[model samples]
Target: MNDAHHRDADAPLRMTDAQHREMRNAQHRETQRAVSGFRGDIEGLRGLAVLLVLVFHAGVPAVSGGFVGVDVFFVISGFLITGLIVREVRTTGRLSLARFYARRARRLLPAAAVVLAAVAALTVAALPPIRWSGVAGDLAASALYAVNWRLADQAVDYMASEQASSPVQHFWSLAVEEQFYLVWPLVLLALVWWHRRTGWSLDRTLLAGLAIVALPSLVWSVSLTQVEPGRAYFVSTTRAWELAIGAALAIGAVRLSRLPRAAMVWAGWLGVFAIVVAALAYGSSTLFPGYAALLPTVGAALVIMAGLAGRGRNAAGTGGAAGYGRGVGRFLSVAPMRAVGALSYSLYLWHWPLLVAAEAAWGALSVVEGILVVSLSFVPAWLTYRLVESPVRRSGRLVAVPRRALLMGAACTAAGVAGAVVVHAAVPPPPQVTASAGSRPATQALAETSKRPTAKPPPQDEPTSITLDPLKAREDKGPIYRPQCHQDQPSAELQFCAYGDLGSDKVMVLAGDSHAAQWQPALAAIATRHGWRLETYTKSACGFFDVEVGVGEPAVPYPACTAWNAKLLQRLTGPDRPDLVVTSSDTNYQVVRGGSILDPQASRPAYVSGLRRSWQAVRAAGVPLVVIRNTPRVNIDVPDCLSAHPRDLAACAVPRERAMAMSTDDQIRAAEGLAGVDLVDLTDDVCPAPRCAPVIGTMIVWRDAHHITATYARSLAPRLDRAMAQAIGGRTSSTAE
Candidate 1:
């Protein structure tokens, strides 16, 4: 069979079969009318993208956003893969399931299996036994093409993971591409199938239907980029529109090829310039796949189109369009680039591990060294390409010995999973990976506490705030570690609210979860001074309903936050008639398990219901509800803070640039609803000047990784005083008790 016997005859990621036929029909049309040789140029572009990805992971400063290379890969994949489908469908009348997957298995599985096997063997030897398990588990996920989700879970979490490390991290893109191949061709093929059955132009039909998908996906990509950038990056659903850009091009290349020669050349020129500029100018800060992404993807599309146009230029009195593929096209087609592109799969496989090993050996790779490491991976890639790639691809041996290779791939994947399992099993199930770069007290402290629960000291040690007897803390009343926990309530005998107690005004009830309870001391003092009664109602991880995720979590036994909030809600709405309801929870921890995220429709409605109930309860009680926004979480554990920096002013601070960025949009949205609610945006105070200093003024803001400290709560007395005054319909006073 010709190497170009054409694989990926159908798309892989979409959910239907008819769609596969449409892709084949359209691709057949391209073949019949001369689709040109831009396909090779697209492959070249893929090489450049994979190179960017390889270098970025290799730690090249120049390619900080080199991860965007994956986005580029996606776009290129969409275009070229779609073109193949179109050609197949137009020629064969039907798409072949066996051939499509067989080719993919041959192209992708061999190198991936070899890499996994090598990594597994190397990791078992090099890594401490403690870490081998996790590395193994991630390997399994990678093998199954599900590492993206696995990595995503760890990344988007509100816990202590900054994503600076994680060896299997590079597999995310491969999984994403595989995922794309799974369904996209089906959509194209289905259109063809539908057309064969309905007699419509595959071009107009696919182009129209794909547009419908593209538009909403465009919205979702931007929305997710705003709400969850990391999730947006790894999730195939969010990334499809990017690839669809390429798919649209493959379907419409005939029209582009027919355009005036000069027009095609200019389009091609504009496209090439965009790709180059994007590569050179963009970096990490850009809100990607947002508007910033259009630059590279669309540019690649135009270049591909132009290259296609160029090939067909002189063919039919079309000089430029039919002349030759050049510029980005020609450059990509050069011997060096073509070889790189051909070996790209192997190169991508080898590069990340090599770089990771190099980093482990040398701590960090300098720009020059990073480049060298990436360059070095090619040596192995070349060997693998000739040995692993060429052999499996050329000889029918791979197919003949499919079981052996399949077993090999499975065994490697299983070993990786087993390693991860062992590592994870040794630790708690929801494994937490921490990167303590420096030997600060915080890191050491975290290392101490991260061990299986042995002895936990009292709640945060400070001037005075909350305290909980670990045994009694789990009482029917719920977690009692409030700010004024150790202190008496507001009263003349108590000399008003003490240090932690701010005050309780108009019988203000602070009701919610741990976040809601953190306000007790501040509100206590303020209420005491203002002659208002302050009551606090809280649950550890529970919210107002049984749905909200708590501070300490997995939500298995159900977070105490929801239970406590529910009780408080019941109590406040009934006899208590508390004049105010102030509550908050970590809006980020939406409990999920086993690679599945809770849908917004699932628990979100409950959250909204709770909010509405709270509002209604306050309305009935004739009280105001102060709904504080969930604080942006810090990744460090509190004990780590005390142990690491002890008292260093700038020690564990979240960089000011990052601090000012603001919390999750979901938190904002959750608070935005409600009839008589007052929002207290403390995002500023939480991350103050010079940067979100580890210690704000004199108070450490966090208790553990995500909770607030009583000291920091006290420091925000002034801000809380103001927020409360507005929270309730009354005059407020501020004084540091």
Candidate 2:
């Protein structure tokens, strides 16, 4: 029965049952060692990270720096995963890719799948239908470990920026880690193969390979953070260096473990200080994962390195596998830290959804309420850790059999996808309401409604909540959007999209930012009805001002807008000039001068000067100009807020004074002395005297916070047409025909 003896029949081969049992026992011990040589210190680090993130989410101002805990986590993950791979390669002389991946599957996928499913189901029930589709897509991406890239794509997307946060947004980090897990092993396998063929030591080879990968990634991180900080925050390339720092430590683990006790103690304490300080000093404006990230990542690296110093039998003259009882290692090995660390994964998974759900249900939370929600997160975290994470992770049968583990992982993935599909299917679409037969003419309706005694419109006059039709409300964009006529800030070329009678000589040009674009529906209606040509030239985030302004995150100078405006000015004054030119802008951006940002107070005069210059040029060309005041800004998303407060739709209205305060009053002053420019104020039409209501005469007034919905815009056609005819001083020769 002894295959070794049978193969070499010439040798007298005899083995006792005791020898066989001993050999089998040794293998079993090695497997157990590989799977369960628990690192209490590492668990404590995990505990620290989760605690930081949880407190930060709890809205504790002191822990503003707590977001850096994610960077710390990247370091810890890299160190531990690389250490395991190095150990296996050193002992077995080759890597077991199947077993390594199977272990990762059991440890990460099961609990993650549970959270994804729960998020999808809860999102459908609790959140607005507007967010459901996004949440569903995020769920599928999270399940497949690709949400980070998806989020990165969305981050720079101007339209999606206004969307509310997804419940599973935290999974972006997990996706990055999962991506590393998939790629790192193959890299390690190649290193091990090269070690077998060539004479290079495995540790040196790994260190060199990690350096090769980490250095360029670090360079890319710094470069991208400078230009596109928003997208850089979520992308994996920006975070790879953080992981590589830990991998490098794992490669030199034995060498690092031999440092002096005193040195380790200082390093550990200093690292903890660095981490806390970085968290405190940093804020939303801090360009992350760039040089700024070095503070936390290096701090985490020090803490991890210091924790290993003079420990684990790797120290010179140390005997056995006993670890040293000195430095931060002793501090981190404490039971409380280990206990929390044990549940860290589940805690992290549960906390974000709870916070998002709390915010969705009850606007912003008080400090005390936030603390309570974070504390309540512990309950589910404990349950998941004990019932799901611990049981499956500890089962030897699961770890010992790669096939079963993979199948289990596959099943969990399938369940997550199925849950998302079911949630999407279960949620019904918004009801479509036809135009009411009793709908009044927009101008006459406003005139009659203004005569009513009370500021609040009566229930009979109130519009049904078109906000409930969330999808329709979001799609209620102007005609310029569908034709891609709205130019973004990056483009200088003029995009001319005409609406209504293009053959008519009575031409009306609409130009400005998205605020101006919102009027296209009404402009088109008037142009078509009166046989006038309506031309549109609008851009997102860019206004009509000729002055330089800082916009977007980090307040970058908008040179494109300046360039586009100059070209527009020239075209408007040329022989091809329209009979009438209309313009409006958000006017929210700060003016940029000599690379310095000027506040609104200082910038208003500059903005006025810019407006005065542009208007003068247009008037010189014999073209009359109409300047419509920017629309009132209701700081909250009207649709989402109305959806939440369905019964009392009036709850979504803002006081007229407060709503009107958002527009720059300086714009009115800028137009006062200008010749041949007529000013039309329709804000009272949209948001009457005392309050700016979300719904005005059966049409939603605003989409998101600032721009008026197309429905509302279209309803204003009759009033706008009258105003346009006056501004142009009667119809032109083309409209006379």
Candidate 3:
């Protein structure tokens, strides 16, 4: 909704009767102009933007680039808000920040507050208990309009990345918009003040100010997206330029209006064409809000500029230029389009939470089911718009007094936050399960190979208790998961940690990506028991191989992984090479060959070759190598599954064959002819034979979908030790300890 035109309330006290009448007439004319100037085309654009986002989130394959719809919204917001501020400044010769912010709060906060509280209630009713605390945190962030920063931090966080998406994650865009609203007015006010002092035209000053803000943001967006795409996608800095584009268009609207009618009509259709093409062409792999965002943002600007040119009334007394009225503007001004546009904001707020809740209750939805769920959200969206948004926005009591509206906004914000706190408090704490006194250390049990039990079918009954609480299982990572030890995706720096008997002469090194890091607890236990020093060289998602690989969704080339792998190989083949090196990796890594990422199946041969090349280098240096076959991946969040099926834990188990099939035998193939290289297959222990249990023995097996819990890994120390001893041809004297 546009801001209401408010004249100075105290002006009449100082004015003569004749002057007061003149002032009232002028104010009435301005108000009438503002009301008549409402762009039906802009309303239709809002409808189109929300529709694109809805279909995109619903997983419609046809609108792969529908995400550009958000860019369109950003541009429209910039144009409308900037125009409001500039118009108020020009007419009154001053701006009231208090009134401006109060209007914004009244327009936005009520509907948002209603949605956040609804999400909290939905979390309690539909989502698994394990997800409550995380959703509560998300709710708190959304309530404060800081969820975008929260989501940005989580995007690059290894642990948080594995967690399910928050229902309020969609609030990230709202957070960005609110942040802009908070800062943009002050910026424009400062520029107007400067224009008055410097004797510069207001248009020139505003345009210069927009350029100053937008240029650097555009550069940062492009640069950051190349290196840190995950974080770049959510952060505010990368998105500010899009809003500035609209502000620039608004500032130049008068100049645009003087353009020929034919030119404006062509520009309008071209803008529509650009948006449709982007919606059809863009996909997940497209680096976003960077250079790619220019298409939609500029397109939105052109459309708005076209609307300005068409503002003149035709002979029929209908709005818009005669030529523009017959073109794209007519289609956008239809009754159905305007209705959708009117409800767009509320629809945007309601659709995502419903979709997320539905998916949480019933696995991933088919395209038809997703569309149905999104369709169902319209009921809530319309209700919220009719009952909450319209009522608060048009409240006469709040409109007359800005302070009252601000206070009401504060109360709504507090209510949303309080709801989150209550939900968080309602989550049950992790349960405690103590180990039996009779059990021997896993290292000791596996060392006595002859007495080791044969693999058996997974049990039909769920265990009454597990060693670690399933709710907190994702935090059960080994030392290698630490930020200082394992490098993140964007860095090529070589960082390693020392564990086990650090001063021992015999050195054992653990190497590879997170898959290799998952075995650190077992290896550390074995190293200490055998009096060997253990050093680890691991990176998140980076494999210890000779070939380059890809990371993130849609799989871009990971230069950091390649550089780190090269540095690691140099250390292994150098004069101070360890006595033995143990390596493992997730075989699903896509190979980056000839500047293109190969599909998983196509990448397999390249991975096998890379493994052999690296192993040969280690062997040529006279260092023995042991390859831990990649562990089984359950292909679902084990903790989430277990928490959802706590009473029937067996329901979370995956068939042994399916779980084992997750790993390719690339390591075994690589070690086939290499004399000093040995392969250890732990699939039998981790999965048993008939099925893979989410909880094996007393401990939860998998921390997430693929990685094993540190608690479970420690339990396998004895088996790892025995296997290492046999592979190396004999047990050392320290093994008997």
Give me the runs in candidate 2 sitting further than 4 Å from their true place: 1-38, 195-198, 312-326, 431-468, 489-492, 573-577, 596-623, 731-737
Predicted structure with the largest TM-score when compared to the true one: 3
Better of 1 and 3 by TM-score: 3
**Lowest lDDT block of 10, candidate 1:** 488-497
* Per-prediction TM-score: 0.58, 0.86, 0.90
Writing each residue's lDDT as its tens digit, candidate 2 over 1-737 gives 58976767744333556577568646533442433245666777888888998988888888877889999999999999998887777667678888898899999989998888889867876786667777888888888889999998887776677778889999999999999999999998887777767878767788878888999999999988765677888999999999999999888876676678688888977887888899888876577778989998998898887766755443222211134355565676677888888889999999999888888988888878888998999998999988999899888899889989989999988887877787667666664434456755343344454534333333222344342564667678976886569886568788879989989988889988888899999889888988889999888777777788875565556777888888888778887888789888887878888977687789888888887788888888888888888888888887777666554556777766788898867678878888888887787777774666776656667788888899878877777777767766765322321
Candidate 2, RMSD to the unseen true structure:
7.5
- Candidates' lDDT values, in order? 0.60, 0.78, 0.82
lDDT of candidate 3 over 93-122, digit per residue (tens): 789998999999999999999999999999
Clashing pairs in 2: 65-279
Q: Is candidate 1 or candidate 2 better by TM-score?
A: 2
Clash counts per candidate, in order, are 81, 1, 2
CA RMSD (A), model 1? 14.6
